[model samples]
Target: MIKGINKMLTKSKLEFLVGLGIIILPLQGLAAAAPTEMTKDDWLGKLKAVAPSVICQGFFEDASLKKRMEELKIDNDKCISLIPASFDKCQTQYYSGLPATMNKDSAAKWGHTIGECIGTDFATKYLVSNPQASTSSSSDQTTSSSTPSSTSPSTPSTSPSTPSTSPSTPSTSPSSPISSSTPATSSDSQSTDISRDQWLAQLKTLAPAMICQGFFGDPSLKKKLEDRSIDNTKCVNLIPASFEKCQNELYSNLPTTLNSDSANTWGHKIGECIGTDFAKKYLLPTATPATSTSSQ
Candidate 1:
């Protein structure tokens, strides 16, 4: 009886150990099958969830992404499971905490980005918000889009009995005027864009306005101005907040020479160098002693 009881107890203990081992063994290997983990897409579905968007934009231009873009090409679209990840990056970067005023400098950058991937309308609207967008051709902001209709209707046929040969008709009128109008308008527009870029660069730099004008206003200046007949009043009405900030930024770039009784002295020197009225009009109002920045 004693032997039978000991044998039964031993077997029961062994069975319990075996069962515990079975449970504990799998727990120790929690990551052994991690290779089968679902991807960002598999978990989030077709559109990436918030996590992926942040990873794309926050990590865009990261060296790894650039390498991935080049090496994978079309395949790159699928490599990370986020299709066309670069665009995800762009949207994130563009809308992220942006400055309200799209000044000449800001507009150029946004325009370049827009040109590469987005529709033109957003880019033009962004530029219009900047004071520097005034290079004579912002008027070209006009554009319209068309989408294919979901349903199509059959075309009606003309009467079959219509005479095959009609009476002699005068030759189609020349469209030379239409053709002529486009080239001049196109050339003028191009000129204005070129000018806007030049002006943006100069205003962004330490270059004095006269020096900048000289550089941009050459025969090429026409090309730099974005619009020739910019309506300042209209511009203010369009984007008053940005316009106000951009105007402040424009003056911010002016020379430190404006900070002195020496402004009068500096103006004389600048007039001698550039032979222009810029210094007189630009510097006189803002001139003050060097230490007076806070008082203003």
Candidate 2:
């Protein structure tokens, strides 16, 4: 009878141990599955490394823009240089505003914001026709100035001829009265108006593509998305919605009139806003588990 009781006790103890092991194994698995959270510094370091690629990729995605950059001899190194101190401050402020700890998802979401900021900065600084024009203008001015100096000796001989022609020149000028300043002013106004319109239109078309490319081009960001099982196609599909949200938030506040400078400024801001929105929606992990449990 004592032997029988001993056997029953041992069997009961074994069953209890087995059940405990079962419970502990799942708990261990859950702990392992939880994402490791990073501090602000870690996140900032990662973003700084990743943002330049994203910014350059987005800014040069347009074939013409890429070609123009090549012509200007602007390379990725120059692209990195365009990241301003203000942008560093922006990133610091952004991460400081977030929770003390960030998971991969949160890090990636904010990474997009950093990319947007840098890209906008790059576009604002380098995307204009001005840089190329200025370069060419300098050379032209140098050549034209030399020509005038070379021709100055002939001016004395022509002085007598000038008096005779000057009378006719003034008469013809008064009759037609072409105000050089007026035509230039009119031409400038039309050019500015057209450029502003064209810029706004191009921005509308290109902003989405830029945001999408920037988000995916960064190696770290792409890995984060991959870890979440979010593919490029999924994110691409989300762009229209993301872009529309940003546009509605930003576009209304645009000044009634936009010149080249103002357009560049606002365009940068708009791109930044779009990137923030896109990341918030698709990059950040959803609280689906909590919602599902709550519903149940």
lDDT for model 2 comes to 0.37
- Please name the candidate that would achieve the greatest lDDT relative to the true structure: 2
Candidate 2 residues lying further than 4 Å off, grouped into runs, are 1-191, 194-201, 287-296
Specify the poorest-scoring 10-residue window by lDDT in model 2. Answer: 151-160
- Model 1 Cα RMSD, Å? 33.1
TM-score of each: 0.15, 0.34
Q: Which stretches of candidate 1 lie over 4 Å from their true place?
A: 1-93, 119-185, 189-296
Instruction: Provide the global lDDT of candidate 1 against the true structure.
Output: 0.23
